[model samples]
Target: MTTASPADELALLTRLRRDLHRIPELDFDLPETLRYVCGELEALCDDVTARYGKDACTVFSPCKSSLCMFFDRKSEHATAVRSDMDALPVTEKSGAEYASCHQGHMHACGHDGHMAMVLGLAHHLAESFDELPRSVLLVFQPAEETTGGARFICESGVFERYGVDRIFGFHLWPDLAMGEVASRPGPLLAATSESTFDFHGKATHIAKAADGADSLEAGMRFVLDAYGYMAEQAKAEPCLLKFGLLQSGQARNVISSHTHIEGSLRTYSDTMTVTAKQHLAELAESRAAEAGCTCTVHFSEGYPPVVNDEALFDLARAALPDLHELPEPLLIGEDFAFYQRHLPGVFLLLGTGTGIPLHADTFDFDERILAAGLETYKKLVRIP
Candidate 1:
């Protein structure tokens, strides 16, 4: 099959992207969105196979709607490209003609564009199957916004089954201009963990403050001490300890007996991540004990820092054109880190021109950049 020109591919991809944008779905519940993606993959198969007389199979996730298109299944070595298939909970304010039709859910992170670019690669691969060097897999992943799907995908042993050599994924960065790409070899994104603390103490009237074990006081001390430790740690390495939720007394006249504190921990260094969790847990316990209160600390098993494999990074730098090496690590967390833990891979940042940041109500990208993304995916697939 002869592939369409760049212009034709972009035009078709624009339409498909809008169709996906109109029906944004949340994590792990993308029934209609899944159907649309599978339909597109199937359509590509029918069109390209009929024209070229080649064979291919597009596999749909049995439980969810994630789609994987395989070309050259018999080859010993395989290459995979991934695009997430989930939307954030942000409401759309972009006011585009193709803005999300679903309320309170939007593809504000540009996953719709990511999916489109990968599909463009799939279409190109289908059309040019004869010249392809090795087997290729296009993974349409689900629940990326919540950091919930990649783990499941890794656990499914899809990579080992196909003997995938190295994989590539990218996120659109509105912070940079169109046509620019930035990435590095290590810690492109941070590891993220959530910590929750609960304090218990005796309740007493405000006038009888001395009689109460003041759980609120204990919680306050814990926060301040934790923050101080975080500050000190930051002096040595990058770290973030954010306490976004805190609940204490119900009335002004009561010495609170119970308090709940929730916060997020992020760091580029794995050693720092482990140390910080230990420090916070110890501080919470000690402070609560001193205040004559009991405390419970729960740290979530969160995403690890996205550490690009060195060998894979060298391959990407040489293979991708006009690549910019990022100077510093981003504190943002990505579950794509989970994929790297299993096999060599590199996560890339494709610039989308300056605009409203990701996860915002007005988040959007320049459509022209979609071609760059498509080209990048195609290049990665061709990596030998």
Candidate 2:
């Protein structure tokens, strides 16, 4: 048998990426996507396991959407590499010949590229399985865009069962130079929570303004106070609280009886997130009280911040000479944080250099950049 040359491996990865992109699936209900991924893994791995049903956290269960593949080298410990299998809800407009065939669904966030890189790594492992220093686990996760599938994978106890020592994953980033890889020692991505505030008051005709308790006025006051509070908090540490939607009145002649505000809170630390939410709730209540309105605030438990393991990152930096260190943390959220919380893990960003923001309808990248991602993963798994 002959080993696949670098050119052959690149071609294989490009084909895999395009095939996965054409059948973009969302969340955990990925039948075609899982089938394609598993078919590729079956030929390269020693064993493959498919997980279905509810996660330990009891989150949504899309049957047979997640997969774990192992290559046993008779080693005591294993290194894991993860790739998310979900696609965004954006329609394809990239004009590529291989644009998504599934209407209203596309790989706008580069999951297809991520999967290709990991699959390419699998092929590399098979070519040299006998010489591997430790076993390897390939994780194809679902629901990363909607429900935090990494949480479900962790709860399945696969990491403990495989004796995974450390894990690694990557996101294709448009902001960096082409093929450049980057990460930080800690807090590479922010933790986020969705928040909604409802204000209730009395309604009356405009002629009797004094008799009406205005809910819209209360909402506006809360917004102003919340922005000021967040700005002040940011000076001390990185945090963000901003409202995107505010709904209230219907008629010009009548005072509104209710107002609803929806927003998100993003912070780099759990302590900061909890404290900011508490302060915002107090501020909302205070503003509502001033306007003679009652208010309720709700915050959804979203993904935790993606904090890179310090020692693991240091080791990665020493291993990959091309790896760049990010000067500041990003405000975005990623469920890859769940894996880091379980064991020492490092998340990296591979540059697409296309300058298109993620989740956009026309977002696309050159498949050639995937080779850099594959090379990075190949080196990471070899670390002793």
Can you give the TM-score per candidate against the true fold? 0.93, 0.94
How big is the positional error of residue 231 in model 2, measured in Å on the Cα after superposition?
Answer: 0.9
lDDT of 2 by residue, 234-330 (tens): 9988889888999998898898999999999999998898899999999989988988889999999999999999999998999899899999899
- Candidate No. with top TM-score: 2
Worst 10 residues of 2 by lDDT: 50-59
The residue-by-residue lDDT of candidate 1 on 1-384, one tens digit each, is: 567998898897798788899899988899888898888888877765566556655455623557787776467889988989899898899999999999999999989998888888888887777677788988888888785688788888788877888889989898877868889987799898988999999899989988998999999999999999999999988788989999998899999999999999999877998899998999998999998999999989889889999998998888876889988888888889888888888999989886678899998776778888888877777777
Off by over 4 Å in 2: 46-64
Write down the RMSD of all candidates, one decimal each: 2.1, 4.8
Q: Which ten residues in a row have the lowest lDDT in candidate 1?
A: 56-65
Candidate 2 clash pair list: none
